[model samples]
Target chain A: MTAINPVEILLVEDNPQDVELTLRAFKKANLTNYIHVARDGAEALEFIFCEGPHAGRKIQNGPKVILLDLKLPKVDGLEVLQRIKRDPRTQMIPVVVLTSSKEQRDVVESYKLGTNSYIVKPVKFEQFIEAVQQLGLYWTLLNNPPTGGG
Target chain B: MGIDFTNNVTAGGHQVADQLAASFKEISDLRAALDEHAIVAITDPQGRITYVNDKFCAISKYSRTELLGQDHRIINSGHHPKEFIRDLWTTIARGKVWKGVIKNRAKDGTFYWVDTTIVPFLNDQGKPRQYIAIRADITARKMAEEALRQSEARLQTIVESLDEGLVVADLRGQLLHFNHAALEMHGYSSLAECRRHFQELPDTFELHAMDGTVWPVGQWPLARILRGEKLHDLEVRIRRINEAGWERVFSYGGMLVNDATGMPMMAIVTISDITERVRAAAEIRHLNTALEQRVIERTAQLEMANKELEAFSYSVSHDLRSPLRAVDGFSQAVLEDYGDQLPEEGRRYLQSIRAGAQRMGALIDDLLAFSRLSRQALERQVVNADALVRAALEELAPLQQGRRIEWRIDKLPACQCDPMLLRQVWVNLLSNALKYTRKRDPAVIEIGCQTNSGSRVFWVRDNGTGFDMQYAPKLFGVFQRLHRAEDYEGTGVGLAIVQRVIHRHGGRVWTEAQVDRGATFYFTLEEGITL
Candidate 1:
């Protein structure tokens, strides 16, 4: 991942299988924009804010959207969401919560913390594929981000 | 004795005349003084009145001119018996003086008490010559004495008749009086048997303070009152000496009684038995404490159970679904990627695997929902039943797409319930109706309400494949299905969810069905607002 070809989608998920399935779904949906995978919430934050190993990546070279999972290793998804939304440098990046939990509290908390969307990961492969693809097309190609510098 | 002046005049005429004149002057002065101070009547030896003085006339209410020769019976009041008058006469006839208090009547019939003295003047033979009766008025003193005796009798009666124990003691706390109740309180039948002094009280009875400390003699009711201390409900426990294992609770109140001159006259105390009241209050306090302890213990247990349920639900929601997702996703991956290499049976097997994973996921979700029913706070509202049924029907419209279905939705009453949960109930029951009646050429689903008393019973009747009545008991159990999965596809949790929702709203749910006949599910919400 280089700053020359700016990251467009950041998927913050800990489960390796879920990560592969999500990436496959994005490829099937024909979302050609570069997708960066951060295995946990901490790596996701580092990539978004250009810290640690990702210090060379310019913060302005944006990942247009962040796909967040609530249950993750090290730093959980909600904390990662709070940090991203609170900082002026990455606050404008759209965050969508993607998780296997249909728990009411999780949905309510995600929206309350400035999440752009919430979707429960369906058990059936087809439904999960449809959900990921629709969100990908909407955030990458359909939904517009704010123009100009903060 | 009468002076013999006229016979002795020849013997010593000059000397006798001089002495007689001197004696006459002295006697005249003494008679005037006696006339002013006393009521005098001279009675003859035969009991006839010979001379009456002005003082006597005034006391008898008779004129001197009317009673010069009248007998002494004219002023007799008849208050004295005949023997009493005879005794007085006998004393006077023997030349002695008789003194007594006589009640004499006046001419006007009003009585007067007199202190009278009768003197007999002796002749030469020492017999009665005349009787001179002298009297003094004593009416006022006698009346005052009578009034005092009557008042004392009344006070004694009042003190003795009291129900509460009354004790009167001298300032030194020496017992002077005890009413019957006071004696009974001390376990004594008479004052003679009770402790006679305050110092003896501690020996005869053990008196305890409310806090169970023994009170000494100085703290006793009599001693307290004697010290000029006013007592109110001074409660104590008393156990009489010699009466083992017998105790009574009493309330004592007292005051220092003062004489007219403001000096302490005596100490007065009142005692009342309050054993029953004290025992009842103690029992109530004990019960309250026990009840509070039980409630605290129960609440702790319930909280622990709830925490376990929450942890289980969270694990089910997160960990359980991920594996199912992997199973379904990998199965789909196999079928799609290895399609040309795999035989027909392999593809079908992969499809079954995916179907099985998805079905398991659905079951986990429904089970979580049923368990979550216990945790969800019920939010009650006035809901339009007609709107709830319509919404449920509309949500189930996808099932109605390929079929000919007639909906006979009757007018529904408004109700008080948690709208969201109640909607879940309607969805589950109506969906069951739709699913079970899938084989019908024209599925007829009827939704209506029948109000009984204050509660309205709502029912969903459908012409569908019904089951035997014997299995009706298991209809509301989780995953308790009567029909096979090949015949009617279901996880059999719809009615369980329905029953949970209805029960949470304080309502009842039941069903009526027969094999191959239509089933009607009836439910009554506890509070139904009449519309």
Candidate 2:
């Protein structure tokens, strides 16, 4: 197999405890490459579009997948998802909606906006880690995505 | 001696002749005086006038020349009946004198009334030869007698036809007159039966006094009048003898009419029967009492039915939620714990199971809300629509945060409505707009209001995948979802709850949509409520 560039994952989450759990889950899965974090919807949008504070970053080397939280401050997760999907540069990137809300409307709406998958962050810490591990393994290793070199 | 005797006889005969002549003159003067003192006329027995004296001619208004040859028929006024004239002729022809008041006509056709006597002059064999009639003008005395007869007849007719039983008794209680009605009322056959003193009347009974004690006839109406008392309308009960039994009669008594001097001459009493009228009045009172009792009973029954309905609604709201929670919680547990262990097909089936339970839970919640709305009392307050929309959008922020949506809020008017119920209406409608608009690249949500007369209607519009208009009715029904579970996830009770909340505030909710274009939901906070 030809050598591939290391996979980059972007996690947009507001809660500190949830972020810690997500990092622990990635470590447990043994699939760490390059992992980036954005505390709010605004930070995630800047990182994807390379605008505002993230203007110095190279735009061509964006994250392969975005994990978005529906509830966030400054800018909301749905707006970040819409900005990423609307721009041609970030349109092909896979999006996974990660939320604490189990509301049916949230799940249906996430998928309807072209989210690759939707997962509710469980209240129990162990179940949440397990769900993250499975999602990471499936999307990073098994799924084939179009690679457009920047 | 023969010559001397012859001369003496001749002298005596002459002297006797002279004495006879003096006696004849004295008799002729007496006959003339008799003719002036009496009105006399002589007619044949066939009533033909033969001779009339000067006095008879003067009273008849005729001269002797007219009266001497005319029959009595010439002065007949025709006032007397044929039988009256015939009787006069019969009595005179039998040589008896007949006396009567007769009417005759004068020569100038004026009338005269006369008291007349006709005497037949008879021959030696007692056969009538002529009639001698004596008359006196009596017109003034006859008029007085005729008027007296008419007044007496009128009084007699009134006494017989009176409706009241009238009794007139003397001061000693001796009955003077009893009318026909009075005799009938007292059960007596005639006035003669009551003619005895009231005390002696066989059928008379004692009247009750004011103290309710019996009073004898001597102390009754006649007795009061005799004691110089003027009694009027004294009510008394009289006992009457009837074939069935003795009947009690109500009577009124008063002093009888007397001369202007005010002497106690007689007492009068009148009576009537009132037994049937009194009994009928008592029966009507009894029926009225029974009708009042039935009306009270029916009113109590209606009150009881209203109370029972109130209790039933209370149970519907509080008792149905417990089981619904259990179904949803257990299904969620099964999916979370065993989802990975199950195959893909098995996982999908479990997911469907979880969805169904969740849907059922939502339905139960909606049902409880509907029941609660019926029991909730209205709480009215002023609601600023713009502020209310901001609050509801804040609550729904978690759902729309990650979506690309454009919110265009317009100026809205203040409304009079229940604040809490109005909030529920905004939550349901705005959340539905957010959910359905998720498919769009940049979801556009428009929040605005319009004024219709006195009411303000608020709306939330979305550019999303809308449904067929045919299924619009089912949008607010419990568990009635338009999209399949795989395409869209929903419990479908959100819209239904919204509709119920708006309706409770007397408002209305409606949607307009075209397939795959967009959906707009319009609602008012002041439903049937008027300003």
lDDT of 1 by residue, B1-531 (tens): 222335444536878878877877887788779888888888889988888788888888999877877887888888899999999988998889999999888999998888899998887999988888888878777667668888887888887888788888888878888888878777888777653777876766889998899888878877778777899899999988777757999999999888999988888889988888899999999998999998999999988889888888987898999988888877877887787789999889999999999899989988888888889999988889888888888898898898989889898878888889888899999999999899998999999988778778899999999889998999999999999999988888889999988888878999999888999999987764434
Badly placed stretches (over 4 Å) of model 2 are A1-150, B1-41, B51-68, B74-96, B103-112, B119-130, B202-238, B246-248, B251-253, B282-531
Measured with DockQ on alpha carbons, how good is candidate 2?
0.01
Off by over 4 Å in 1: A1-4, A123-150, B1-287, B527-531
lDDT of 2 by residue, B1-531 (tens): 101212333334766767655644555565457467757778876677887777777777899887766788888899999999999888888899999989888888887788888888886889887888877777677767777788888888987798777777776777788788877766778767778877664355646654467777666766776666766666565565335445454546566667679764567765444445545765788777877777777767765654565455333322343343344444555556676787888878766776675666555556556555555677888778778788999999999877788889897777787777677778877887788887887988898887787676778888888999999998998778998878877767778778877777768889999998889888776544533
lDDT (CA) per prediction: 0.83, 0.71
Q: For candidate 2, lDDT tens digit of each residue in A1-150?
A: 544443477889876656765675566556445668899988888888888987877667767677788778899877788888888888888787875434444567777777776665522334433544655644554343543343
TM-score (2 decimals) of chain A in model 2: 0.76
- The candidate maximizing DockQ is 1
